[model samples]
Every structure is written in C-alpha cells, then in structure tokens.
Target chain A: MTDDKDHYIRALFDISPAYDDAPVFQQKVMMGLTLKSWLRQGLVVISGLIGGLYALTQFVRMPEWSLKGGGLYTGSLQMATRRTDATVEAGVEFIDIMARGLADSLFAVGGYVQWMQTPQFFWVSFALCSCILVLYLLNDAQERI
Target chain B: MPQSPGHNSAQDQSDIDLIGRAVTGSHTAFGELVRRHSGALRTHLRRMGAQSSDADDIAQETFMAAFERLSEFRFEGPFIAWLKMIASRRYLKKLKAAQKYLFTDDATLFETPDEAPPPDMRLHDLDSALLQLKPIERVCVTLNFSAGLSHVDVAAETGLPLGTVKSHIKRGLDQLKSALTVPNSSSHPIASSQNGAAGSATPTFMDERR
Candidate 1:
C-alpha cells in the first residue's frame, strides 16, 4: 500500500505544464554552436598576431635616439608641413620640439628597454600569448567534460 | 509489464539510438532528442518553484549545456533522467543566484490552506498546490516522486542530506494530502477551470490516494 501511495503520488507530481519546442530554440542552439567554433578560431588567430607583433618589435630595428639623426626630425617635419598649409619654418620648429619631448620620454624608459635587449623579452611575450591561448582552450575543453 | 504513465516505449527512435547519431555531428538527431524531453524538463523546473518563464529559460540553458557535453553521455540509463540531472543543476544555480533578492516564508505561504479543489481540477490546481510548498520541499518532492529519482539521486542532485530530503518529502506529502483532501468552504487561491462546480466532489490528490 505504501508502494501504491508512492506510485500514485509520483503520477500526480509528474503533472507539469506541457511544452513544445519552438523552432527558435533549435535555431538558437545551432547558432550558438557556430559562434563557439568561430570564437575558438578567432582567439587562435588573435594570439598568433599578438605573438608575431611581439617578435617583430623585439627583432626589428627601432629608430636610433638622436633627435636630428634618426628619421624623426625629417619625417615629422615633412609629415606636419608637406600635407598641410603650414609654413616650413614653423612646422620644423613644432616638429623639433615635439620630437625632443618624445625622445626624452623614450630615454626615460631607456634603462628598461635596454634591459630587454636579450631574447628574454621575446620569450616573455611568447609565453604570455601562449599561456592565454592555452587557458582559453582548456576552459573550452573542460566545458565539454 | 505495465509501463509508467508517460513512458514512450514505442517511439521510433530510442534515446540511445538518437544519441548515437548525435555523437556523429547530427544536429537533427539532437534536436529530436530535445523535442522529446524538453516538456518534462520544463515541467520539472516549474515544479521546483520556478515561475513559468524562468522555468523555460532554465530549460533552454539545460539543453544547451547538455548538447555541448553530449559526447560524455554513457547511455547507461534513460536519457530523460540524464536531462533531469542537468536541469536540476541549472535550477539550483538559478536559486543560488536569486537568493539575495527574494525572501518569503514557506509556513506563511501555506498558512491559508485554501478551499479543497474539485475532484477533476487538474493541471492549474496542481500547479497552485505546488506553489504552496517551500522551494526546497517542492524540489525534493518533484525530484523523488515526479521525476522518479531515488532518494540518493535526489540528495546527490540537490546537495541536501539524505535525511533532509526524506523529511522534506514526508512533510511535503502531508501538506499536499491535506491541501488536496480537505474540502473546506474557504476560498481557493488559484482560480480553477471549474469555478467551484464540484463542491461535494473529492479532491484530486485524495482521490489518487485512495
């Protein structure tokens, strides 16, 4: 009789609001699956690009520190004056002042950049990007389990 | 052998068969599985004290989560049971998230027993009765009786101690019995489809009890 009561209660409790799947539900799931795959690929590409940029910044020849010698003075003067209606003398003065300030700021950080002279900076950048990519993939993989 | 009331013993594709196809990247197979089980899952959520719309939202999350991990399914039991397990977890997470905002006394909620319902008053009345139960009691009762999970399974899913689950079920059943059995002259909280037509009629749960 207890079994009967339990069974009867189960039947009564099983009564629920009837629902049918809206086509939109299926559409949403499929769209989500697509978005998830695309995001995975996109993250990989973004990490690779970041890694490439880091490598380039480390290996490529950056501008030398001389305000007048490195292309900074000529480049800024031409850029500010050639494409504008500004007087050449005024443009050269403006460019020279701006270049000097920028050079001073860069020189302020010269010690840190100098310390990064070895391949350590490249490896650090590589490691950071790789760690980010691995963590992302691991999160996705864990979700599957 | 007599099958359970809602068992779809004669369906063309068994859940295992459908799951097999789903594992091979068949969206149609998965969609079919969702269509097959979503109603029961939604109902289970509703029984657990979720408002109608919230239940549907949780059902959506449950299905999406289940699909992502479809390959992990071992097919050792009924697929509906597995779906229920996932839905229960989602519901618990939702309850945890909402704990900061809502406060209601289960004792106060059930204080007004409301008039006994008509003998034939079905779906809406059942929902109304369930609404009177405390959220945890409702979950325990629905999981054990409605969803057919064992006490251990309910405990495992709900993170409630086994004794607590059993106590909730016992107390819940008693309240349900009274709510459905005693046909008092008091006003019913939920508007019935019959509108007090079956005045002398036995309540649905009492009738089921006999």
Candidate 2:
C-alpha cells in the first residue's frame, strides 16, 4: 500500500494536459496579438497626422522674403516689417491668396485647435477614423475565418 | 509577401533576441515565444486548480498582456519566470473576481480533510486525485513536485507566507500519500518524468533542478 501510494503520487506529477490542435492554438494567439494593437496604432497615426499638419501650417506662414529667395531668413533684417521691396510684397500677397484658397480645405480652420473644432473638419476626421476602424475589423474578421 | 529582408526563422533566435524583435513589431517572434510557452503555462494553471477552459483562457490573456507590455521587460531576468509572474497575477485576479461565489472562506479553504482510499485499491494515475486537494495546496505541490522548485522559491513565486507554504506542502504530501493506494512492492517511474512535457512550457528555468 505504501509503494502503491508513492507510485500514485509519482504518476500524478507526470500527467500532462492533452491539448488538441496546438498549431491552431498558436495561430489563434498570433491572430490575437496582431489584431489587439489597432487602437494604439490608430492613435499614433492620428497624432502623427496632427503634428504633420502643424508643421505644414508653419511652413506656409514663412515670410515673403524667405519664399522669394527659396530659403528661411531668420536675421533681424528679414523682420524689418518695411514694405519696400515690390517682389517681397507680391510674395506676401501670393501667400494671402494661397491661405484664402486653403480656407475651405483641411487646414484652413485657423490651425489645428480651431480646425479640430469645426463640424466639417470633425466629419472628415470621423470619416477617416471610421474607415480605419472598418479596415481593422475586416482584417480581424479575415483572420478569424 | 516577400520575406523580410533580414528576418530569420524564430527557432534559431534566443529568447532575448526574440523579445527584441517582438518589441520592434515582429509578430512572428512573439508567436514563437507563445508557441514555446503556452503548453507549460496551461499545465501550470491546471495544476493550480483551474478548469481546462479557464486555464486556456488565462493562458491566452497572459500572452496578450505580455505582448502589450513587452517593451517594459528589461531582459535581465529569466523570461519564463517573468511569464510565470504575469500568469500568477492573472490567476490571482481571476480568483479575486470569482471569490464571492467560488469560495465561501478563502482563508480556511485548505482546512478540509483528505479522503481515504480503500485498502485494496490500486492507483494508476493521479489526475482525479489532484482535484481533491485545495487550490493553494495543489499549486504548492505542483510547483514543488512537478516544476522542481524549492519551497523558498515557491513561496517567492506565489507570494505566500514561508510557514504557510511549508505547511501546505507538508499537508498536501500527507493527503496524497493516504489517497494513493498503489502496490507497495512494485517499482514505479519517478515523478520528474513529466518534466519533459513541462519543459515545453518553461524554458531555461526548468533545466536548473533544485
């Protein structure tokens, strides 16, 4: 009886759980890891887009002198504020025209904060987000099948 | 799709290398880690008293949580131990959530007496016998007997009091001895034989026998 008890205890230690279709389980785990990051990935993309738009707005607001010379001029002379050069004034007028044309485009709602508040901009963002969400769900569903 | 230019088979990579790749968004590397560990993790959970489906669910959740926070892994410790820690946390959380219905008094759960086996009974396996012990006792015995962890290590791993851990192990062994009625003269296989199967679940850590 003592040996029998010992053997039983020993056998107990050796029992292994039998899982069916291990590779299938592995594939399922991989599918989950792949699909789980959608929310984080989407947030990263959205934030990156916002940062890019801000940089673009800054680039477009460059002084007329800088645009005429095709380079940024940060010297005090560039900040003189005098409307002496006709070419610089023309460059400034060209920028105003461009900004007005873009008034109805994506970035024209007075930079990121103001643009983010408009219903039209909201709908565009909402549409973009919806598309991303749909695509993410589609990929997840494909993996499931 | 074309093969990733520099990507190699995950089988050849060390765990640290796999973890590095996983942190950089290589899902295949992470998948390999999961394939390597899931079996042992499931076994561990089962031995800890989880039902088969619950064990599988917890294993899945453990891997998902580990992948989400892979960057936080410092690579200084054994990866399996880290995984075990995560699994332990998830198990504790599950226990806490189910405490209201599953256990009437969590502290005194292990106070039940061991059922006696008939004098002439010949035990062939321990599967159903294991389910007879309390959850904590089962966990302590499995970690100590199957995984070859020392009592100190088991205490550290499970975060149970040292005395309590010792008591659980002693009581568990006694109960198992009484419940198992195998023939006294028959030579039998050692308990550590299942170490091979458990090896798949735990990697480097299992090789270091206490």
Candidate 3:
C-alpha cells in the first residue's frame, strides 16, 4: 500500500495534461474576444458601421471622384467654393456641401436623422453613431428600470 | 492558433507588447494577443479545476470578455493577472452554478487525466494531496510547486496577505500529511484511484505512518 501510494503521488508530479486538445480548442473559441467594456454594444455596432463607411470613402472613393465628380457629382447638393482660386472649388464645395447637407438632414430626419445624412458621409456616420447611442440609452434605462 | 507568431518563446516581450496594443483597440494587435494567451489560459483553466468539456467554453468567454472590455484594464503589472482573473471568474462562476464548494476538497469537480492510474489519485500524488487540502491551500501549493510562483506571487494571485499565504501553506501541508499518512482502505474513494483521491482517511484516523 505504501509503495502504491508513493507511485501514485509520483505519477501526479510527472502528469501531462489530461486534455491535450483543450487549450487549442478553447483559444479558438476565444479568438478576437475582448473581456467587456463600458461601451454600449449597439453603439459599437453603429459606430463601427459609420467608421467603416468613412474609411471606405477615403480609401475607395476620394482618389477616384473628388475631381470631375466634385461635390455636385451627385447633382442634388450645391456647395460654395471656400477659396478665391477655382482650382479646388469642387473639393472645398464637397466639404461645405456635406457639412450643410448633414446638418439639414439631422433636422429633417429628427430622431431618424442618423439614417439620412445629406452631407459628407462623415456626419452621416456621426449622426448614425448618435442614433445608436440614443437607442442604447433607452435600452439601458429599460434594463435599469 | 496554438500560440502567437512572436510568442513561440520567439520573443515573449514582443508578444506581450502586441497584446498590450490589442488591449488598446488595435484589431491586429488583438488578433496577435488572442493567439498568444489563449493556449496558456486554457491550460491554466484545466489545471485550475475546470472539467475538460467546459474548459474550452470557459476560456472563450474569458477572452471575449477581456477583448470587449479591454479599455477598463489598467496594466499595472504583467497582463497575465488580468487574463488569469478572467479565467478564474469564468471557472468560479461555473463552479458556483453547479453548487460545488470552491473552498472545500471537492474531487468530483475535477476530471481525472487518463494518463494516470486510479480514479481517486491525481496524476501526481503530491498535487492530488494538495488538492485535497482547502482551496487557498491548494492554490499556494500549485503556485509554489507547479507554476514555481513565489509566496509573494501566491499572495498576489490569491489576494491573501503575504504572511497569511505562508501560514496557509504550512497548515495545508500538515493537514495533507494527516490525510495521506492514513492507511489506504481499498474501498475508499481515493483508494479507488479514480479522480486522483478524495481528501479523507480512515482507521484510528490518527494512527498513521510514512
């Protein structure tokens, strides 16, 4: 019995893992996970969408269109040139028009303004984020209540 | 992945740094971070007493929670503590849900590794003996023996006062000896050698020897 006990104890010290595959399997499940955050989940989604759009615009669209297409490329929005030189009128017009359009859209859309921005996609994104935050707050309040 | 690109012990510092960046909301940084700590955390979870079946799920939950709420983390020391905390909570919550007592000697909760013989005996009798002790005691012994963590590290990990950790270790050793020295009755659960030994003994319950 003494020898048996000793052998058992010794085996434990040299013990290999019981489940060799467990760590790998678990980690796969954990991929891309963050612990938790104060950031609202819905807000993250909305912000992510807005930011993604902004990036897509910068990388995918700016180089291609801001030239002949300019701010009026879409045709409905009109924007004033910021500089005396006409060389970059369209670029300046693009920024100004986007700003004004998004502002007006916010008022026109009211609560849903986030979904319908008239200006540059950036403010549309900002408004969308705001909408998400508001909705998150409502749900959060309901949870608390 | 099994581990991270850089952390194959290729460069622990670089991997840790990348993980820090991930915690800061860098998507690629987080990807590297996940690849780095996930394996060790899973292994640690299994060692910490999670069942093999649940270990993966628990590990996943821990990482996800860590990634999503990383901004709240303040890396005052090594980030392992944070990861450990996440894994610990996930495992502890499961234990709580099962109504298993974390502080007590509960062998039933830990599954037996097949490499070892006997249902009650742990793969290593020593670790098994340590497990038979109380939770804090088990933690001290594990850190000291398995992880090679110092008493100070144990205190840090367990939130016990430094001196208290030492005392727990001392007292835990004594009780473990008391438990182990008793003559093995074949019918006993530990004697059955299934999960590596439960934490009790028999006979005079006092008359024992090496």
Q: Compute the TM-score of each model's chain A versus the native chain A and list the values.
A: 0.48, 0.33, 0.27
Q: How high is the CA lDDT of each candidate model?
A: 0.63, 0.64, 0.52
TM-score of each: 0.62, 0.56, 0.41
Supply the TM-score for candidate 3: 0.41
State candidate 3's DockQ.
Answer: 0.08
Pick by lDDT: which candidate is best? Answer: 2
Best by TM-score: 1
For B140-199, candidate 3 gives per-residue lDDT tens digits of 654554344678877776666899789876766565545454335333222322211223
Highest-scoring model, DockQ:
2
Model 3, docking class: incorrect
- Deviation from native of the Cα of residue B35 in model 1, angstroms: 1.8
Which residue runs does candidate 1 get wrong by more than 4 Å? A12-17, A52-145, B1-12, B100-114, B118-125, B177-210
TM-score-based ranking, best first?
1, 2, 3
lDDT tens digits by residue: candidate 1, B148-194:
78889888876778988899888887767655543333323322111
- Candidate ranking under DockQ, highest first, comes to 2, 1, 3
